[model samples]
Target: MLPSPLAAAAPPLPPQSSDEDFFSTASTSTSSDSKPRSPPPTLPQIPIVWPEAGALTASWVADLMQAFEWASKALPPSEFPSVLPVAVFDKLVLTASKILHKEPNCVRIDENSELNSDCRVVVVGDVHGQLHDVLFLLRDAGFPADDRFFVFNGDYVDRGAWGLEVFLLLLAWKVLMPHRVFLLRGNHESKYCTSVYGFEKEVLVKYGDNGKHVYRKCLGCFEGLPLASIIAGQVYTAHGGLFRGTIITPSKRSKKKNRKVVHNPKVDSLILGSFEELAKARRSVLDPPWEGQNLIPGDILWSDPSMTPGLSPNIERGIGLLYGPDCTEEFLKKFNLKLIIRSHEGPDARDKRPDLGGMNVGYTIDHIVESGKLITLFSAPDYPQFQATEERYKNKGAYIVLEPPNFDTPMFHSFEAVTPRPKVNPYYDFEDVIDSDEELDLVSMVTDSGLQQPAV
Candidate 1:
């Protein structure tokens, strides 16, 4: 249950629906005229559970899982009911927004981030819309139990056909176990990116205006999400790799002697802003100064790491800074941290490289052995890109089960993509799919696929 203050501010609940109601045809909530209607008569209940405080019972979660699986299997995922209905999503947006408002622009966390000697945490990265995989992680991996705590490293939406399913399910679980789940912002969780990516378009096509509204509200929640998390106060976690608050040096020598390259040294590279400072870095930040803007709102959301010696512009991505092992080491020492756990890049491959995966891999650790510093965690395995037809060994994904933060040994779980995902079209380009209605779909296709630290 939420604290008294937060509970008091909760949004009004819509009238209850039966077990069969969610999958039933949606009501005309999207009548161009925005008229408020009276509440529906309360039903006895579905097999689903909606206990007090929005806390879900185990039965409810199981039902929700079955609901999503049934929906995806019933029709082509790109169709109308492939995703959650308009009214349901609309209610969810409101609830999610209220919860987000309770959180500060930058959330502060000190206690929960710390893992006791016996406690273990599961750090996840970049599910990227693999709904079946997420189900596997929860059911197969056994998450969301009262005892387990989770720190999701973002990149939750986009790239997969089931992005909405993945996101809403995670959000539902967050509401279920608010204190045990932690969500960090990823590079993809913004307006500009989602607009270009398939998330925005998918909603518009599936749920229409209500979906658009829910997408907007989701962005608001994204804006309010914390940029970085301090784990056990010893590890710093974020989506992108690293950042510097300010420039300290002006120039640097290149590989050739006397050949100077332009380099702006950071004043304090390792010091992530306190919760108050992080809270201020919100949705407004789109690109970095190097790309266009002078002030990037959250560096942790955009930055990447390099193999060289110091911090440098990430010309390849056209934004954010790239740090080398030396740079990572300095940042860790500067902040008095032992490790920097990050996502943003894929674990098996550099950029979701198809056919570049293998078994027994879920995360990549860099700088830890050489510099006692960074570990990169990419949770999406066998990232099935639309054009990826080639068969390869590197199609497995991985995650880390951290044991009490005692010298950073995490148990690894790796698996390949399950069957039942769309085969012809990539997730980002789903909107472009034209009629070949007779065309064989993944239906015949056969593809497959949260903790909290602080609010205010």
Candidate 2:
């Protein structure tokens, strides 16, 4: 059996508390508008055995799939269902965090490894807690094995009913096969984002009294997750696209009354950070403060590729930078890489770009510079699982499969949402989950600090 990093404990029965008690004011509670809900059926006691490396065979995965199926079919809980034992959950998170903590901010999957040289790599995008969908994706994409590798580009939790289940299952796989499976950090993985979104509430409802401890453990695991991965030394993959270097210069502008002395950063003056720099990044920070040296981690997790021509601060998100075609080319050319694969946007961001076929396709090539292409992949279909009928995007989800040898060319596999997902009550008010960073008001932070946003 794999060594347990934490002692297993029985899951304590949670004290009766309304869902509102867990979430912040920013999130509208689902309990407020809906009819009075019943407490979830208690899960019967099941003997828990921590996974052994040898025991983590296909049957182990199948058992996990079966347990998740039960959890998915059950009604949404006002509190955690305790499907995963507290001890098992603790040991899983602690073990996974320990493994992740040893990895650098940027993980390299090179072709030099004899074992991986002929393996196929499947790169998955954001899976925002859609357990059923993830299961389908795994079945469709084929499970990770000695000859088939998997790279999940973060955003494992939040937005859906099964975030914790989805996250833990992936953690099991990570512990089972660390070299073949890579988990990169997504913007939603942060403590701040989970608190603002539904993950914190999901954990609380799922784990009850132990929810706080589970959630804290989740944050620790998030801290340990690597920021990005380089596949075959040719493709760069991250949840967010690109980042700016350590250099940030205050622009010289004449003082004029009423005209804000913006810290206009010169596009040329900004540097696209190197993999060496990415390796040196302090990714353990739970929520990077998005200023000074902290900007690198925040940018790596939050930045988006722009159709524009230069790198500039992502004003809309209030964190990370919006990089353009030129920036993509620069980054790729500098690293001698071929493509950039990232995932953070969903239908909302996809539909805005009608030219890119909108939400019809799961992946989009946002920028095609001379060096290579910058692709955006979103794997959560009909995203934001619980939404008003009129607002649904009805989008398909996708994953990219790269063959052995070069691993440069990407083959896209897009699939529609699984039919008839188990009916679960919404956790957070749909209206309250705004995508922009304005909720944090970090733009005001820029002005307050007297740093004018550099013109693109």
Candidate 3:
């Protein structure tokens, strides 16, 4: 059952758009039918394209740069991080929440919210709280709202030491460029995950134990973030991949029966009624009580796409359902979307075959499911947490600068791990606990179901 936080303050039902009529139809393929593409080349470790390139190209960048410097220096060469004054932290989080509140729970980016077809918008994946990589990413993208539009596909916190610095930088960008910059909810952002993964302790370290208040405030912001974003009316971007949950379908029995469908307007423009129960749920209050993994929220934040043909329960992850090509086709067709871009997994720089989604192409995990539509772009180069060592993190981090007119395929600019910090000490006894990351079943369903050549 989903958590009901708004028993007395129940939000009004969401509006249904006339365009939802497109959800049930098959969308035309925007994928390339061209020959196999060459793998993207590697980039410099510290690709400093910022201050040296002249002033940053955007307005909000200067402020973000200032905050970035403060955050970077705040951490002495020690393990413990400096604290943010409760008032200062409160102002920061509250400001971010206020901006996020303007977006729907299930946000629909209208034409005005999107850039032209031939615009280079940067798309990035999991940063797992690595602050330096984020700075590198900003330098690589030339900073948000500058010459390019940016979409951070989630996992902004957890696993690394500087999650606070990284997340605040993104929030600053969002507050500054509400339209030009977008942030999606990630698996790690949820309170349940943070308490387990590392973000909670990071907060406690940075702001003191009493700073659980800041943690709660962080949850408030996470709750407000959109689940997915549509770019240029063609791309469907989210932190995790597809979700197969309580399917809320409008009755086919009679058009009149579904005409007055009631959904939470605080949720989305699409009237998804009971589905709102799941979407609007206070996921921080799930099973396992105050700790441990729960089901519903787990899938949205944790699920992965399988190359298999049908549905399968992902017992390994213990929560999310593993989806296949048919599921991908249905989701894209349901939303009339051409591309499904997710970042829960990275690409494999070593693997040249795009169909074989693995840890080779920067662990990208791209599949030719229902055509060349779904691509995973992991952005934290030389990941600096858990057991993500220099060797394992070799798959250079990347951002897709997408444009149209001729924007049929995205161009990936990948950079090698930049002056990465050492891995965080394991919080658990590996001898006692089985490493979930090692046990992850991602890419287990690798096979060529008439694999199509990637446009990359």
Candidate 4:
């Protein structure tokens, strides 16, 4: 049975759209020989209603999910979907981006409010496409409501064959229930990652010539996604783990004494970054190169916690920091938080870093410090959806339910991947996929794609 949250204080449902027509069907054409060609695939759509006209019905959203699932399973790789009259996709993306842009880098969800008294907040990890599993997850955890909120810790696209479907569905929910659904930006959300990962290729395959426009809109939406979220003043959630504290490092100096030259560098003093700093940080960069003081957004979206003490660079990923337990304790104590929940690793990363557990169960309490616990959650089961016989991780997916009043302890729900997922080919070449720590030659990637270099 699906788990139920405390009684929800859901607001009155909005009036449904009046129009009965919803499906935007594809047309099949015939050759002069009279042999019918296969019908081109089409994106999922509901009654095209303006935001002011009325909110989309729950039934409409449900239908959209079903439509996406069906298409992913039935459509062939050679056939690209028609996304013309692109306004339909544009409307949802632009509207959701506007809402997300206005949100602070760290969105705060306070507890003890009239609406949150009995409600619960569901925290989900990376869902790199995998639409069928997402559908199963929603059904398992219950949909977002006024009381039951959802904080999706990024990585919504890439890897799986149905990223476009997964992303659009989440955006639809965000537009319909903005307050209840908080979508944080994962490192994969950036342009560089998408260009290297399968998302960009997936969009091009799914939308044909109009794919560029749709992909551009997705980049805009990615820039608007928040970096982190604070739940009920107790839990801290980000796609990656801890962010770096402000620091002042002295420059190197040389001193000559007794005809000998000596070079000395002053030690660096660290000051943990505050919520105020996080709120003030600029996070709208389409792609953060993780350079200079501008690295706050990178840190938030890419950093990971370590067993060692204090903060150091996340050398493994080539960006962000590998903050130790001391860092976690200090950050939690300073902010009065009880736990840190983040998601980015999968079975692949786990194999390399076993200190964080096998990830076979999908969630790991990486660090249990005196101040609180730092948990790592991965919601995509059997991650890296298309894998060779030797590459399968066979891991379960999981989500966390945080109950209110205190909202400290997290109830973990783990599930296996949906069976018989649509058989589809990977859009990207296997050689293009690289290790997490490796950097892609972006200029070459863009040049090969016949597109100009994106602005740094």
Once fitted onto the true fold, the runs of candidate 4 whose alpha carbons sit more than 4 angstroms away are 1-54, 77-85, 111-115, 248-271, 388-391, 435-456
lDDT tens string, model 4, 30-119? 112112211222334533334455465565465566556555655564343432235667777887888899988888888433337678
The residue-by-residue lDDT of candidate 1 on 165-228, one tens digit each, is: 7877777776666666777778778664566457787666566646667677677767655566
What C-alpha lDDT does candidate 1 achieve relative to the native structure?
0.55
On TM-score, who's better, 1 or 3? 1
Which runs of model 1 end up more than 4 angstroms from their true locations?
1-55, 78-83, 104-115, 247-280, 283-298, 347-360, 369-371, 392-394, 405-407, 420-427, 430-456
Task: Give the C-alpha miss distance for residue 438 in model 1, angstroms.
Answer: 36
The better-scoring model by lDDT among 1 and 4 is 4
Query: What would the C-alpha RMSD of candidate 3 be, to one decimal place?
Result: 15.9
Quantify all predictions' global Cα lDDT against the true fold. Answer: 0.55, 0.72, 0.55, 0.72
For residues 1-456, write the lDDT of model 2, one tens digit per residue: 111111122122334344332111111112222122222213434333566653354455445555565556653564334456788787777878888999888888875443365578889999899887787677566567777778999899878778888898898888878887899999889876787668998888877888898888898889899999988889999989898775533445633333432222355566687676677678887664644455678888888887788888777676778888999999999999998999988887755555554645678888888999999998887787876244567777888988867899998888766545676776676676664333455544456555654344
**Winner on lDDT (2 vs 3):** 2
Worst 10 residues of 1 by lDDT: 447-456
Which runs in model 3 stand beyond 4 Å of their true positions? 1-74, 77-84, 245-297, 346-356, 363-365, 369-371, 384-386, 390-393, 406-408, 420-456
Candidate 3 residue 206 Cα shift, in angstroms, is 1.2
* Superior by lDDT: candidate 3 or candidate 4: 4
